[model samples]
Target: MRLSTRYLVPLIALFACSSPTTSTPAINSSAGPAGTSVSSPSSLPELAADPREPFLAKAVASLLSEDHLLQRKIDDQVSREAFPKYLEQLDGGKLFLLKEHVAALEADIDHLDDQIEAGDLVLARRGAALLAKRREVVAKVVADVLSKPFDFTKAETLETDAEKRTYAATEDELRDRWRAVLKLQVLERVEQLEELSDALAKKKPTDEDAPARPPEEIPPTFEGKEAKARKELAVRFETRFTRWKDMEPLEPAEMFLNAVASVYDPHTQYLAPAEKENFDIQISGTLEGIGAALGEEDHFIVVRELIPGGASWQQGKLEAGDLILAVAQQGEQPVDITDMPIDKVVKLIRGPKDTTVTLTVKKPDGRVETISIKRDVIKIEASYARGAVLNLGKGHEPMGYIYLPGFYGDTRGASKAPERNATDDVRKLLEVFQKRKLNGVIIDLRGNGGGLLGHARDITGLFIETGPVVQAHAADKKVEVLEDTDPGVAYNGQVVVMVDRFSASASEILAGALQDYQRAIIVGTGPTHGKGTVQALVDLDKLRANPQAASAADSLGVLKLTIQQYFRVDGESTQWRGVVPDVVLPDPASYVDSGERSLFHSIPWSSIAPQPYKVSKHSWTAAQLAEASKKRIDSQPVFKKVEAFSKALKARRDDTVVDLKRDDWVAERKRNKAELDTLDPKLSETKPRVEVTPLEESAAEKTAPKTAGDKNVKKRIDKWREELGRDPWVEESLLVLEDMKKLK
Candidate 1:
């Protein structure tokens, strides 16, 4: 469960100069126009309200009713369903609000539909007020609990899973709950400090100049470590509370509207202005910003990774794991962002090209420095398709390996011809593979969350000699079979497509089509992410009744409306049940309950009439390969350990009640770490089974650097090749390809 404010943002000005009109049909509502008068609930507490929210809500409701895949009405039933969803977005962990507060909110649950229909945000306003009150109370409770030392010897347990617990019956119960939660936080921090201390103590000096750590430098006592943890946790909570208090009314309103949208399906959503812009950047694989991927950790905006050849990477000052403390324009005072929302922080940092933005960041080692970076157009090279050549040491042929992070396309460019896209990139790689005459190819789609549907179709065509790729079933009961009419295959070699639970949407389309046509063997831990539904970005600005009120409508945001459900060429819909792979691998991800099936209000699986298609001549029987793979897996020590690790993970996930006692917690952490170590041995410790190398042309490009950006590009490619060489999955794919060669 994610908070509503998480989606609210003005991240970048990349596409701010242009507002591309969506193809989604505009909705005309009978509920008057923008700024129409609606009766407000006098009983509800007064809170700042955005004038554009009512119009946005009205437009969203109209669009969903008219164009949603399910064509479900926004009635009393939807209202009842939305109420709990709204609550979940507000207080997902069941931490802030008490049982009495939930009971009070539930009073207007049945009439929520009426409120939305009337363009009145009575429920959202009331809920926001209640949440604000609870947040202040919770903050105080957290501070009070962390002030005193906890009894580490007491054999107490804490129910960590939010779903398994209910709202606290009373304020006293809530206080006790916070006590346990804070103790767990402090205990985990203490364990981390102890581990660091131990690692430092055991370190060996490499040279005479290398200074050894003094005995006095290490914190010897557990009590001191506990005190440090508590102090840090107090600051973390203080920052969190400050951020929550600063949240705008639009954020809650967006959450409330999304609850209404989600009643139809999980994919159907309302994208706030900033969120829509972010979505565009993701699909296009480009952004004009600082070029650093930021993530919120303990309410602090931390730089996760720097895009190669990006502004931040070129600056050479910002590093991954650096916590941004403040933002300042050129010659401006630094604005403190201690607990600011990540989106808001991004808004301050992202600007026009050649603009200088100063960021005050705290390094991992606690060094604080202010660095200025000139914002530029950042092309996310990692998001595009890239390939490498893989070989098994002796008496084995080299196979082509391509990893596509997403089915990306330049959406911001003219529709007639995009500057760069996934299909073109993959096609170029295939051409190189064809030139080399590689016996087989492995397309790794693991952890790919999908992108453009058209790109998925085009890429699938690159592998096969043209066929029906997927079927789209619309709200009007129309079945449209999307086919790849292209006449020739790019590289018709023995193909192996790797997937995991995270591979979804466009990823599912390609994998499922290849599997259905018998063009490739799908190998994964389990079924792919079953997000079969298609969503269209409906610009709410275009749905306004009065076109002259352009200024008012511009800020209305966008609705990501679910319009259709896609199915495999074999007629089976990858909705609740995703595409199951031919070969199952022992992976910890398989044990986790996730994907479309785990999502609330997810559409049920359905099938249509199978499309006409011819099976590939190069097809190998999956059963035979499965049998061979199973035999190898059963004998392999690594796979055996993987199986044990998966089971242990499943057991841990099932049992959320954890021991809060410091000693017990430490023991459990050690056991978990030991399991992880066995599953993921150090890269240096493990011998590489498969050797990965760049293609001849790619190697030449790496040596001939025309600019500093080219050097960074080479570094990225080299890093990719090294990581691929160490991958167990890639090794397995190599062996599988070898088996295919023999079978052929």
Candidate 2:
């Protein structure tokens, strides 16, 4: 989450000049003619009164309108914008209400700010109610549609991009949309089944040199496959409905709260209790859970990804893309969750810090296994900085590489030195590098989302002797310049900082400061994730508390507010436009919709007067180096193919509509796969499917014989080491370091 706030009068003038903000709420005339069958904005039904809302309203109104560090006011213009934002938040897919329903409520659009001000949620409640109604109707309509096999030969298309779509005119039309969606799903699945059947029939090649038969299924006769797909899809829909039914009552309120929160800035949020705890866990870099981010896929709960230091990540047995079959507690029968909702499955998986849960998993290669995993409090090892000494050439040139996954601080508190922070770890690694007499060093910040700002300052201080690291301007026109107080340079060697599009917030801060100071050759993708704003989390309980007694609404969540905007020493604000690297690398994800600019209502970029700073070192002539690197890449066929693949992927991403015709749909799928295959083979090599190390297996701490947890940890280390070997990003960074060494 990245953000910012107001400050100097010039900043005020900048915002004011952009658009003339309305003082009073104004109704948008574009809603419709006044005499149309649709009623006026004021006619929307009133929300039922709740006792807690008054207190909640008082807090929200005060925060967004006045108390926010930005002091941003929710005037008529902002409110009108909220109407569409809130609608999109609820139904961006255009899956629920009809245009008539939207028109019926158009009268409410202009009046949303008033309700937000008055602590009323009539419009929000209406949207929620309509979604609920639609969900129920969709379940039934989908069931009815799936009762018969889909006509794959039918010439038709369905708009996949919901943003470009209009609401259906009636419930029947909505059901038709649902029917088409189910048909597409069924068709997609039958194709999968066809491929699976063909692969099953083919015998494995005995010769090691011979390649396996291509998975291209002989044209499916469509025989009984469509019926089987429909049946399977019907079961999946049943699970979806069950999952929808399990929706918590507070979810709508939470969504409404977020809708209001985003209006202030994207980073500012009202963290519910569970959300707050999760936030704390991320900050502390420890938690008690499976440590895997799970998602519902094809009616089965699947492991979408794993946290580096999380339990699931430690257990190398549970791989990403593996479908979770069932979950069982200790000494209990495994409950088959073929059609079970994900939340319920998660609840079963997460438990007391020291317990056991068995997960039945189906791997991508069709292997099935019941893996018992001990639920230990997982410390996110990946979140911390790890070091590797790379030998550049056969001449045995050694270079130190430290990968900071996030700007994690010593949450355990600094007793002697700084605790388990990225700064302290980097300092240790740099010390080791000095001992080894390395040629150059690479500080890889790729995919690092960022954490503590203080850590970033201290980390930057480790490189530069002393100077201003970052400058923050609050809404009250107060400028607080954060400087590197430590007058010590740990690493004076030639340096290269590696970053990517995902390097944001604190990551951007450190990279920006280094680039400005000319202390390091910033290498990798251009413009890191732009998030140069500061958020201060305030507990609602503390705000509402009296000196002696607290309010009963302490159960209400904490509010993260955008307090200030940060600027680089060079005065550039990394808000919409993040820090550009000295040497821009060819990134596969460059074409993807990413960074702060992609966010709705992100603050505009600005500049303050640049702070006075000195450059300690300058080895590489950046322009010449960048030009040389660009030529090296542009001339290569592999890089050229990658660029083409990226363009094609982005084009497919932009093309929202998908053909419903089975032949067309299948053909489109094949075309994409073929195109992807034609590109560099390494493009398909996503992440290393790795195993455990021997060190993790030597678990002397546990008295019991080889437990699943111990074995899992060992397997994970093997994968981690293997990943380090195959990582092309790391390879590129080393090459950049070599380039830096040659520069004079």
Best by TM-score: 1
Candidate 2 lDDT tens digits, 589-671:
65566688888778789988989999766657788778777777777565666677677666767776888997898788778
Tens-digit lDDT track of model 1 for 1-744:
111222223223323633323222122223223222223333334345567767877777777787788888799999998888888877878887777667767878898788787788777766776566677778888998998889999999999778788988878888899899889868866765666576656665553212233445446798888887787678777877876765543666777898888788887877666455555544443335888777654436777556655788667789766888777776564566765755567779889988888887865533355677888766566456778889988888899998887776776656565446788888888878888999899999987778889999998999888789999988888999889999878997889999988788899999999999888889888898899997766656656666347552256667777778998988999887898999888774556566899888999999988999998886468988888988887887777766776676666667778899878977886787676666653543567787888763553223232543444566666766766787777788778888888888
The number of clashing residue pairs in each candidate reads 0, 6
Candidate 2, residue 295: lDDT: 59
TM-score of each: 0.79, 0.78
**Model 1: residues with Cα > 4 Å off, grouped in runs:** 1-50, 195-225, 273-340, 345-383, 410-418, 548-554, 678-684, 698-707
The window of 10 residues in a row where model 1 has the poorest summed lDDT is 1-10
Error of 1 at 140 (Å): 2.7
The per-residue C-alpha lDDT of model 1 at residue 532 equals 92
TM-score of 1: 0.79
